[model samples]
Target chain A: MKNLARYIITRLLLTIPMVFILLSIVFVVLRVMPGDPVSSMLGGHAPERVIEQKKEELGLNRPLSIQYLDYLWQICRLDLGESMVFKQRVTKAIAEKLPATIELTIFGILITLFLGVFLGAYAADRRRTVQDYVIRLYGIVVYCIPVYWMGLMLQLIFGIWLDILPISGRTSPRVFASTFEKTGLYIIDTILVRDFSALGDVLIHLVLPAFTLGLVLSGIFVRLTRANMLDVLRADYIIAAEARGIRHKKIVYKHALKNAFIPILTMMGLQIALLMAGAVLTETTFSWPGMGRLLLERIYLRDYPTIQGVIIMIALIVAMASLVVDIIYAIVDPRVRY
Target chain B: MATILEIEDLSVHFPIHIGTVRAVEDVSLNLEEGEVMGLVGESGCGKTTLGFSILRLLRPPGRIVKGRILYHGQDIVQMSEKEILSLRGRKIAMIFQDPLTSLNPLFRIDQQFIETLLTHEKGLHKRAAFTRAGNMLESLGISPERLLEYPHQMSGGMRQRIMIGMGLILSPDLLIADEPTTSLDVIVEAQFLDLLNDLRKQFNLTIILITHNLGNVAQLADRITVMYGGTIAEVGEANAIFDNPLHPYTQGLLSSIPNIKLDKPKLKTMPGSPPDLVNPPSGCVFHPRCPYAKDICKVQKPETFSKDGRLVSCWLYG
Candidate 1:
């Protein structure tokens, strides 16, 4: 237990420099680009004097060093300045959009865990047979597909072609007005208010997008888990368990799957980082009002403050997710703490 | 004594890409009730495969092509999967080579033991099962408190003793141990053998001890079966095999055992490697390595020649 505390403390301290490095990169990369928010907002039609006055007001007329120091100071204070596009606080804009992206990733990952592990364990149990071959081929094929293309195809089929599910947006405007906004997530909000109709609408809208993201992510998990489970199933302990005449199901699920999932948990953390970055393509395609779509609009409007806020937020999330995975791994296998 | 295990013409094969790797072929042995039968052989001689075959635990592409593992009058090789499962752990239990790898690393010793006991005997509550498991371990000289610890937390000898305790929890009719002492030091090995001797007498257990060490066999075996190239080279009393080895392979193995009393500069090694199971030699699998190989030894497989309860498969004896 003392070892775990020390391990966690060391990791937490280490992330400080990592987050600083990421912040420096985000600040420099945004400034390196040749664009100004004032001109982009005015679209090159404004007078030079008016632009100069606007730049002065926004504190962009200051030297680069002063700007950078000031930016760092504001970041330390959790003040990300204001978004030029939304004309609101950058932190507030992100806080609103953050929940939607998180919700999607959560649902997508849940689906991935269930389907991937199930299929992988099944394939291993039926190894060397036709069913095993077929499942493996399917895993490889899906793994080769690009997520954006898959997401678009899902939209085309489930949205435009079949027209059973919504093509875009989080929910109908009626539910937006009627549902209580306790959690910012409409589904959760609806449940909190016991509003079934709004929940149905939100869930229907979530299906195509979540299904598309989940299916793409599941390919990786299927192959990883199948390989790991195969290795675990052949382990001497599993054979010993079989010799003890324990039921085959108990051996697979209890012994083999438990051992196999350690690596999977670590991989899931890495995939969470990927999912945060990948959500830009997914959220934009679905017209979901998430941080990724906000990022796109802010980029077009040269809203550097919002972009910086979003990027820093993402990097921090990735780092924290990895930290959580390490903790989980230590807990699962006590040898790791030592 | 009546026979506890009767292996008749047992041949276990592995269907590799090239062809069948005949890991264990044309082997026959009989284990009398309450006797310790030591199966001695070098690595890849199919001793472990033969042991696994008794419990029907051979995974593909390794399979029993032809065999009769008769317990009493019932052929276990022909028994249904469910019937075999019932027999395993309850009637015939086995201890593996590496105790570290043979227990689930994720679970505690108590959990593993309780699960094994409850698996064969259902409707048994977890607490009662744990008590029985603890008693089993305590009987094997391991403390009951150690049951809650993980396999990694224990020393190698402790884990091995726990495994032995687990194998005898239900008082099995027969116990098959495959190189149980290979991973232990010489001192630990001797202690384990002593424990096994005491346990056997206490439980009235019949045992099949599979190993390459002649010393281990000399310590505990009532009889011995020598295997080479995946087939039986000789089968006889421990005293007879040690004193007057019949087959050339047995002679070579006995000669290879190093003697500390003599100032022998080099330990003897058999001239050639064991034959490849996939494409073994035309006649005797040992003919290529046997100094006694002749025209008949290279052309025709020899039949077993028996005399006074001893058997040897060699043309010289035939």
Candidate 2:
């Protein structure tokens, strides 16, 4: 337990430098990009003097080193500065939009795990059969399809032709207007307010985007899970378990799957970054009111603070997620020491 | 003593893309109750496959193609999945060659032992199962407290002892040990054999000890069965087989054992590697390497002949 705590602390400390590097990169990339907030905001038709005045007011006219240090200092104090596009603090904008993205991501991960793990294990258990081949093909084909393309295809099918689900937006306007927002996450707020119909509405709106993001990424998991399951199934202990007369289900799920899960868990941590990347495309495609959509709009409007802030938040989350995975790995696998 | 196991015309084959690898072929053997049978063979000679087949635990691609494994008059080959599940830990158990790999690393020692006990004894409480496992471990000279530790925490010898304890906890009628001490050091191997012998007597276990080590067989086996190229070469009482190995293959195996008593010992190795199961030699499997190979040995497979109250499969026996 003590070792785990120390490990977590060390892991967390290590992320600081990683975040710093990412922040520096974001800072450099945003600065070196061709667009200026003042010109982009004014549609590039404003007089030079007016643009210069606006740039001065925004502190962009300062020296590069000074601006960089100032940006870092502001971030150190937990201030992400005001978004040129939203006319609000970048931190507040992110906090508002983050919960929706998080909700979508949570659902996406759940779906990914459900589809990937079970299908993968099924394929492994029934290896060399028709089902295994089908699943293997599914894993490969799904991963090959681009996330945005899949989202559009799903939208076309489920939204237009089927017309069963809403293709765009998070919730129906009626539910959005009536439900009192408490947590910023529409699903939870609906549940907390005891609004079942509103909850249904929110979920109905969520299915297309979340599924789009989840299905595309689940392919990696399926392949990973199947490969790991095959390896674990061949382990001597699995044979030993069979020899002990343990039921086939227990051996497959408990013994083989448990061992296979360590590597899968590690992969899952890495997948968070991929999931976040996928969320950006899914959110923009669906016009869902989430961080990804917000980041896209801000980038178009040359909202430097908002873009840098969103990327920094994502990098931190990815780092923290991997750390959590390492801790869980150590807990689950006895051989893993600090 | 009653016949505890009867394997009649057993043939285990692994069919791959190229061809079927005949791992065990038409080998007939029976075990008397409370007897230790040493199954000796070179690597890839089907000794381990035979051991696994008794429990009907051969994985995919490797299967019992033609055979009847009768455990106390019940055909294991025909047993349903549920029936076999019940028969496995309750009636027959197995210990593998590498103890480290045989035990699940994630589970504590007690969990592995208790799982076996609980699997066979359905109504047994978890606490009672733990107590039983701890007692079993104590008998094997392992501390009961160490049951909480993972398999990796223990040394190879200790882990092997735990495996033995688990195999016996259900008091199975037959125990198949496949190269159980192959992974242990020399000193540990000696200690393990002694422990196994004492346990065999105490529990009256009927074990099929599979190994290439003739020395281990010499220590504990009452009856010895020598296998070569997926076929049984010879079977007889340990003392008789040791004193006068009838089959040429047996003679070569016995001579290959280094005699330390000689002033300058010459270690004799068999001329060629064990035959590939995928493309085994046609006639007598051992004839290619047999010192006294003849034209008949190349064309016709030898038949098992009863001579002096023992079975020898060689043209020479004819």
Candidate 3:
């Protein structure tokens, strides 16, 4: 317990500087870009008084160093400022949308983990056989198909053709009133109160979009698992395990699969970040109303606060994903620990 | 005496795109209960191939065309994969040649040993598994604390000892020690051999000691088989093979062993390389390098003949 505490503290301390460096780079790069945030907000034909007022309001009239210090101060104070388009606090907007994006990413990742490792190992265990070829084909086919194309195809077939699931939006309007009254994240409060009907509604709404997102990411996991599991199976220790009269399934799962997880685990955090990047396409198509689709909308209106806010959030997420991955890697493989 | 493992006419051949390469050909040997048999040959002489074939680990390309690997009178080639796996650690086990490669370096010794134990003994919880693993390590002359150390943390000698201990932990009826101590230093090698000698007696283990070191073969193996060009050139008691080797290849191999005797002449190497498996010599594979080669020797292959209770495949014996 003490060791774990110390380890977490070390990780947290290390992450502070890393996050600062990332934020500094993002701030500098955005500043050097060929546009004035003030002018971009106001139309070019805006009166000079309006422009001056906008510049003063945004605190853009200060020196570069003072602006950076001011940005750092806002960040330290947790005052992310207000969104240009929504006219709401950036943090409030993100907090409202963050849950939806997280829910999608988590469901997608869980599906990928369960199916990818299972199929990869199964294929490796039966190398050069028909099953191996079939799984390899599946991996290749899914990997080659872009997520956007696949998401549309799924919506067409499953939503339009079958009508078994919701075509767009996060939840059904019928149940949205009675079932989930609190947080818009219908899945959680439903499960928290053991409301099966509400839970089913949430799940019914979740499957198509989550499955679409998961199906895309699972290809990478399957290939990684197949490659890593095959390598581990060839290791002498696995042969030794088999020689010891261990059942074949145990050898594949416990011996081969666990050893294969180091590589898989390293990719998992990256996959979370990738899923967020991918969610934009998914949300736009599905009309899920997550930050991804919202960000896209802000991009069109040239909403500086919303655009910069979303980008900063995305950067923070990517950085945090990597930090979490490194920490987990150290935990799982003690050899990697400092 | 009951034979623990017997391989008859076991041949492993690899069919290439262009030609078929024979790796182990027409080789036969037997290991009695508690007997240590040494298989001595140069690299690529099919020693390890023979070991893997017994385990039925030969994947594609290298097919066992005609062979009968009879472990206690049951043909292993006919056994299903599950049956073979059942026999692997319970009845037969193999210690790989390179200790570094044998162990998965990513795992700690305790994790690997415990996993090995749990694989054989079902439902053995982690505590019991750890206890057994630690005890096995201690029995192999390793300190129990070394169980926590990773494979990299241990010395070559320690790793080799751990490998032997892994093979012995199951107390299999037959243990195939394939060049068990080949990668260690001379002193470590001798210590490792001695450790194996002690463990074999303790567990009544039937061992097949595979190596190219004639000196170690002489000290360790109860019986010896001299392999050349993927076939057994000579098979006999170690003393008999060392003293009265009948085949020319065996004679050449013995003559090449350097003796440190003060008055004796220095050793000499055999002439020419081993016969290529892809295109082996038609008649006697060793005829090109044989000092007593004749017109018949180049045209006619040698036949196995029994002499003094040992098998020798040489025209001179014929």
Candidate 4:
């Protein structure tokens, strides 16, 4: 336990500088880019006095070094400033929207995990058979189609054609609950109050968007799980396990599956970062208010503060997730610890 | 005194795209309980194939085409998957060729050993299983604390000992050691073989030692079988076989061993390469390389006949 604590502490200490460099680079690059943020947010034809006043207000009129120092200071203190597009404090904006994006990502990942691991384990159990072929074929078909197109198609089929689910937004219109409610995420608010009808409506609304997002990830997870499981099967200990007459399912799950998932956990963490990056497409298609779709809109409007804020936020999330993965890896296999 | 394993008319054929290769052709052997039999053959002479055949670990493309591998009195070939599995680690376990690759590198020693124990002893409590495993490790002259380490942390000899420990822990009726010391250095190899011999006697274990080293057989085996080109060239009590090898191939093999004669020239080697399994020479498999080859030797395969209380597959004995 002491060794694990030391290892984690060492890794955390090393990450401090890396986080600083990452945030610094994003902040400086956004500042250096040739854009009049004030004009872009308000109007390109705004008067010079008004533009100058906006620049001073945003601290853009200061020297580069001063601006960098101020940026670093704000970052160190966790004062992320305000969103240019929304005219809201950055922390407030994130607190409101972050939960929705996080919830969606979590649901999508859970779906991927449950289905992907099941399929992979099943395929390995029936290796080289028709069941294996069919599972692999299904993964390939789902993987190749674009997530946005899948979302639209699902919306068209399930929502528009069948009238089984909502087409857009988070909840049903009859709920009459104002969108101003600060539950941050609609699904959680409904579930917390034991509102089954509202929860069902939220799930029905979530299906098209979450499926669209999860389909590609599910394919990747299945492929990774299958590969790792196959590798574990070929491991000498597994052969030893078989030679010992341990029941087949026990061999598959206890011996093969858990060992197989060690590497997959690391991959899953990386995939989380990739999924967040890809969620831009899903959020745009579904009109789900999340960092990704917000990033694209902010980029178009030249809302430099919002774009920079979101990019920095993503970089930090990715770094943190990767750090968690390394910790989990050491926990899973103590041999990995130095 | 009682038969433990009996192999009769065993032939393992490997099918290639071009043609089928007979890896082990009509080889037969018998083992009594608490006996150590050494299978001595040059490389590629099907020693390992025979070993895998006993374990039924021969995978696709290579198969036991015709054989009765009778463990106790029941034919293993007729056993179902579940029945075979039940017998595998409990009755017949194999210590593989390479100790390093034979262990799972990703697992700790405790995990591997405890799992091995549990796999064989179903419903065994985890604490009791680990205790037995630790005891087994200690009995193998390993520190019980080493169980916390990984395979990569141990030396080759240590890993080999662990493999032996794992095989012996179950107290199986037959233990197949397939060139278990081939990957170790000379000192480690000799130590490992000695350790194996000691463990066998201590556990009253039945051992089938497979190796290319004739010297290994001379050291430990009660009986030795010399295989050449997928067939047993000779079989006898170790002392008699070493002293009076009857077959030409066996004579060549024994004579190839360096003697301490100052005046003697370099040891003589068998002149030709091993016959290709895909298209083996007719009659005696060793005919092309046998100095005493005759017309009948090229046309007729010799039958096993007894001479001096030993079996020799040669025309002279026939």
Candidate 5:
């Protein structure tokens, strides 16, 4: 236990430098790009003297080294600065939008986990059969199709054609108007406030966007899980389990799947990072009030602080997730240690 | 002695894209209760396949094409999945070749043992099963406390002993040990064999010890069955077969064992490799490699001829 704790601490400490590097890269890339906040803010029609004065007020007219150090120091103090576009604190905007993105990501991960593991195991169990071939085809086809196109198709089918589900936004206007916002996550807030009807409304609105995101990612998982399962099923221990008179179901799940899951768990951490990237397009297509949509809007408005802030948040999350996975891996596989 | 296992015309084949690899073809053998039978063969000569087939554990693309594996009058080949499950571990257990790979790496030793016990012995409490496993481990010279450790924590010999304990925990009527000590060092292998022998006597286990190393079974097996190219080359009493190997293949195998007594022994290897089961040599499978091969040996397969209460499959016997 002590060793494990030490391992976790060491792993966590290592991520600090990683985050620093990522922050530096984000800082450099944002500055190196062919645009400045002042010109974009003034619609490129402002006088040179007025633009220079605006740049001076925003501290952009300072030396590059001074600006970089100031930016780092501000981030050290947990201040993301004010967004040029919203004229609000970047941190506050992120706080407001992060929960929605997180909720969508959670649902996307759950759906991906369910579809990937189940279908992958099923295909492996019936390898070389018609079912296996069909699943393989599904994995390829789903992965090949663009995420936005799929989202649009799903909206057209479920939203316009059937008119059974909402095509845009996170909640119906009536529910959004009545439900008191607590966490900015409608599902959680509705449950906390004991509003089952609102909860259903939130979920119904969530289905299309989350499914579109999840279905695209599930393809990678299916292939990963199936390949891992095939290898695990062929292991000598699997044969030993069968020889021990253990039931087929128990052997497949307890023995084979447990071993197969380690690799899948590692893959999951990577997919979460990918999920955040996918959420940008997903949120844009649905006009969902999430970090991705917020980031897109800020990018269009050249809100450098907000863009850098969101990317930093995402990088930190990806790092933390990978650390958690590594710790879990050490726990599950005895051979692995610090 | 009562016949515990009788395999009649058993043929296990692995069908691939090229052709069917006849791993075990037209093989017949019988085992007496409380007897240790040594199944000797080269690599890919179907000895391991025959061992796996007894419990019907042959994974696909390898399957029993035609056979009747009768255990105490019940045909294992004809049994349903449920019946086979009941028979396995409870009635017949197997210990695979590589101890490292045979045990699940993630599970603790006790969990592996407890699961096997709980699977066959229904209504058995987990605690009781755990205790039983600990006892089995104790008897095998392993500390009961070590049961909590994973397979990787233990040495190769220790893991192999745990496998043996697991196989015997259910007190199965038959145990198939396929190259059980192949992965152990020389000293560990000898210790493992001794432990196995002691346990066999204690449990009155009927073991089919499969190995290419003739020396491994020399002291343990009462009867010896020599196989070559997916067919039985000879079967006889261990002492008789060792003293006078009837079949040319058996003679070659016996001579190949290095005699340490000679200061500089001239070890003679067979001229060619084991036949490819995908397309085995016609007539006698051993004809191409057999130094005494004749025209008849090339054209017609030899029949099993009994000589002095021994079965020898060679045209020379005719």
Candidate 6:
């Protein structure tokens, strides 16, 4: 327990400097860009007096060092300043959009975990056979595909041609208000409200986008799971297990898969962070109102603080995911706590 | 003697990128019930392969080509997957050389023991399995509390003892101990051997002790089978093998050991290595290595001859 506490403290302390460094980079890059936030946001039609007033309000009139320091201080207090694009607090804007990206990733990772491990075990068991070859080929094909193109194709087939699923957005505008009452997550909020019809509509909209993202991600899981499972299956303990008259299913699932899962879990956190980044392209293709799509919009409006806020938020999430992975790794193996 | 396992014309071949290596050749041996049989050979001579084939534990790329491992008159090679699954570790258990690698690194001693029990005997409760596992460990000199400890937490000798505990937990009919004491120190090795002897008698276990050390074999084995280049060179009572080894390969192996009984000027050593299985010598596999190799020994494979309850596969013996 002492070791675990020590490990957690050390990780959290280390993450502080890393997050600061990433934020500093995002801050400087946004400011150093060709355009100024006030000018780009107000546009040429705005009067010079209005632009000056807007610059003062946003603290652009302050010296560059002071502005940077003020920005850092606000961020330290969990404040992301204001979004010129949304005319609201950057953090609030982010909070509103975050749930969608998370919802997509939750589905993606679930699919990845389920398929990665299952197919991986199947491939290892049927190694060098025709089934193994076909799985390998399938994994390769899925891994190399452009997720955006896959999403469009899914939308084309399931949404337009078949007309079975929703092509875009979180839910129908009529049902969206009902989902907003409980949790920000549409599916959960729908359940909380007992709005079964709205829940069905939300799920219908989610299917194509989630399927596209999940399928693309599943390829990596398949390869990683297969490779690790193969290695673990060859381990002496596995041989020992086989010699002990342990049924094949028990040996593979209980012994081999559990051991193999460690490496996959270690990689999962980093992949989740990457998935957040990937949601940019995925959300754009499907027109989902997630943080990635919001960030794109703020970038067009040259809303510097919101862009900086979004990047910092992503970095924070990545750091938190890494911490979660470390905690999970310690839980699974215990040795990592030391 | 009542026969327990009869391995007839058993051959195991491993296919590599270059060619197939005939790891275990046409070898026939009979194992009697509750006897300690020593299978001795140098490294890469397929002694391990032969031991594994007994339990059908041999993995792929290496497979039994032509064989009948008759366990109580039932050919194990011909047994279905289900039959073999039920046989291994329940009917016949195996203990490997390096105990550290042999036990799962990730699992606790109790977890391994309990899981092994529950795997073979379904509907066995976890608590019941755990109790059985703890009792088994306590009997083996490991405290029941230590059952929760991982395999790495224990010493090599302790781990080996734990392995032994696991092997005996189900009361298997046969035990294939492949160099079970090779990793331990001399002191630990002696203690482990003694424990094995005691356990064998207690369980009435039929143990096939596969090893290269003649000393270990002499201490435990009642009968001996000396393998060379994937074939049995000699098979006889342990006393006859040590007293008057017939085959050139057996004789060479016996001489190579530094006999402290007589103060030898220097330790004797075999001149050439074991033959390559891909393309062994045209006649006898041991011809090149055998000092007694004659013209006929280089051209035609020798036939086995039985004399006075001993079998020797050599032209010189003929």
| Colliding residue pairs in candidate 1 | none
Off by over 4 Å in 1: B263-266
lDDT of 1 by residue, A219-327 (tens): 8889899999999999998988888888889899889999999999989988987787667878998899998899888888888889888888888778888888888
RMSD of each: 1.5, 1.3, 3.1, 3.3, 1.4, 1.9
Off by over 4 Å in 2: none
Q: Tell me the TM-score of candidate 3's A chain.
A: 0.87
lDDT of 4 by residue, A186-263 (tens): 776776777778778778878877887888788877888888898888776676666655677888887788788888
Candidate 5 docking DockQ:
0.89
Candidate that beats the other on TM-score, 1 or 2, i.e. the better one: 2
Cα lDDT tens digits, model 3, A44-100, are 788999988877877778798998887778777867778654568888888878778
DockQ of each: 0.78, 0.88, 0.49, 0.43, 0.89, 0.74
Docking class of 4: acceptable
Candidate 3 interface RMSD (Å): 2.2
Q: What lDDT does each candidate get?
A: 0.88, 0.91, 0.81, 0.82, 0.91, 0.87
**Residue-by-residue lDDT tens digits, candidate 5, A188-289:** 898998889888989999999999999999999899889999999999989998998999988887788889999999998788788899999999999988
Better of 3 and 5 by TM-score: 5
lDDT by residue (A1-338, candidate 2, tens digit) is: 89888988998888888888998988898888889788888877898899888998889999999999998999889788888765798889989899989999999999999999999998999999999999999999999999999999999999999999899888886666344688888888888988899889889999999899889988988999999999999999999899989999899989998899998998999899999999999999999889999888888888899999999889888888888888889889999999
- lDDT over C-alpha atoms for residue B106 of model 4: 69
What TM-score is obtained by chain A of candidate 4?
0.89
Badly placed stretches (over 4 Å) of model 5 are B263-265
Q: Which whole-number lDDT from 0 to 100 does residue A287 have in model 2?
A: 91
| Chain B fold agreement for model 2, TM-score | 0.97
Better of 2 and 3 by DockQ: 2
Docking class of 6: medium
Predicted model 5 interface RMSD: 0.6
Minimum summed lDDT over a 10-residue window in model 5 chain B is located at B259-268
